[model samples]
Target: MKDIFTNLYNKVIGFFQAEKGDSSKVIASNRLKLVLMHDRTNLDTLTMQKMREQLIKVISRYIEIDQEALDLNLEGEGDAIALMLNIPVIRARTLEEIEAIEKAEEEELAQKAAKDAEEQEDAEGSSDESEETEKNTKDSDESGNAEESVISEEEANTEENLQNEETNETEKQKVKKK
Candidate 1:
């Protein structure tokens, strides 16, 4: 009797619910795509366009450049930037110009490395003690039979010591990178 009434209630509730697509959901998906593109190239939309202009100016300084044929596009799918620089056939640049370009690339890489290091430091400081304990508890719970599955105090202390050693090594590496 209870099952029949519950089924009828569920059917009645389902009948009047309308299915609809939300505008915010679409906008959010578009925003994510745009932001990811910006993040992968490390340049926002305006900056990327400006970079194209600057690159044209630099190339024109060295040789006759066709602005219409130049294509400087940065598109990235996953963790890699696809830089497309399609300029008309021109004479090779001088040694000095090549060195200048190399320096620009190295500086960009250094900026990315610094940004990553700062983000890592921020993340390390954000995880609360309760969250860490809960993770350990969940890990232990997932490993074996409940009857014999208890972390010993000594085992916990050893793990903590190991973590400390790893932390020290990480700090040393960070200092060296500076």
Candidate 2:
């Protein structure tokens, strides 16, 4: 009766839906494109301006740049979008200056890598110490503080199963007594 009509309606809807593909998927794809466009263009005017200013400052330091003639814009070329930077340089930088800048950048990167490696080592050492402490506690609990005893996976599983059975038996006995 009602069930037959509902089933027919569902079948018809599913057939049409399968034929046309999912409308929600199309809507989601459109929404994602819009969000990506917004992100690519730096939708926040303040952030965009700040980033442009930062770029100008950094570029000016390397060469004699004409700030007023600089162009920073997002351009669409076919399916891809690119952030194009057109900076007019007042004068060409000397080779010595360029080499100095490269050397400084390399030094900075090397220092940063060393610092990162030291931090990683410190993190790993601390984690290892904590893991050792945890292992000590677990070993002490299992061996009753006698010594570190290595048990096989099968033995550990069997011990766990036996403990569970004992607990179940105790619960059943208490229930019976009650």
Candidate 3:
């Protein structure tokens, strides 16, 4: 009982002696509030951290910011929750600079598309050349076969004429003998 009383007296004295701007107390209160908000919104710490990072990245695209001084928090009363963002901007990008960036991106895409189209055309051209070569080879083979058949027919006719001349000479010899 005496120890409990002594502890209570010490705590009271410490509270009175505490500094007016104690940062630790403020930090603890903020943490508690954040936890409660997260619970109420069905959100987790990892999700909140990811949101913060994405927000910073998107905001940085339009303006130069002091990332270290940025503050992001969730504040609400009852069922109405609101996101509070305090971002410090050094400077904003000019419209011309943004337009130039977009133009460069478009040009790069156009160049890539043109290169792809050229490659496709080259591939089709090679295939077409191969097909033409095959056609020429087939035509030559057909012509060669036709020429060979014509030569064989001419040889056959010449042999028939030679046989007829030999028969005539034999008949003349027999008549002379008789």
Best-fitting candidate, measured by TM-score? 3
Kindly list the per-residue Cα lDDT of model 1 for residues 52-152, writing each as its tens digit.
Answer: 66897677656666565565555566666677787875676687877777688789899999998986787677778756776898888756433232333
- Clashing residue pairs in all predictions, respectively, total 0, 0, 0
Cα lDDT of all candidates, in order? 0.67, 0.70, 0.75
Query: How would you encode candidate 2's per-residue C-alpha lDDT over 43-159 as one tens digit per residue?
Result: 653454556678976786579787655666665655798777888689967888877877887899999999989867776878677667767988778565223222333344475
Candidate 2: residue 4 Cα off by (Å)? 68
As a TM-score, model 1 comes out at 0.29
Ranking of all candidate structures by their TM-score, best first: 3, 2, 1
TM-score list, all predictions: 0.29, 0.35, 0.45
Q: Looking at model 1, which ten-residue stretch has the lowest summed lDDT?
A: 145-154
Best by lDDT: 3
lDDT tens readout by residue for model 3, 62-98: 6878765566778877788888898868998788866
- Candidate 1 lDDT at 93 equals 69
The order of the candidates by lDDT, greatest first, is 3, 2, 1
Off by over 4 Å in 2: 1-62, 66-69, 76-83, 127-178
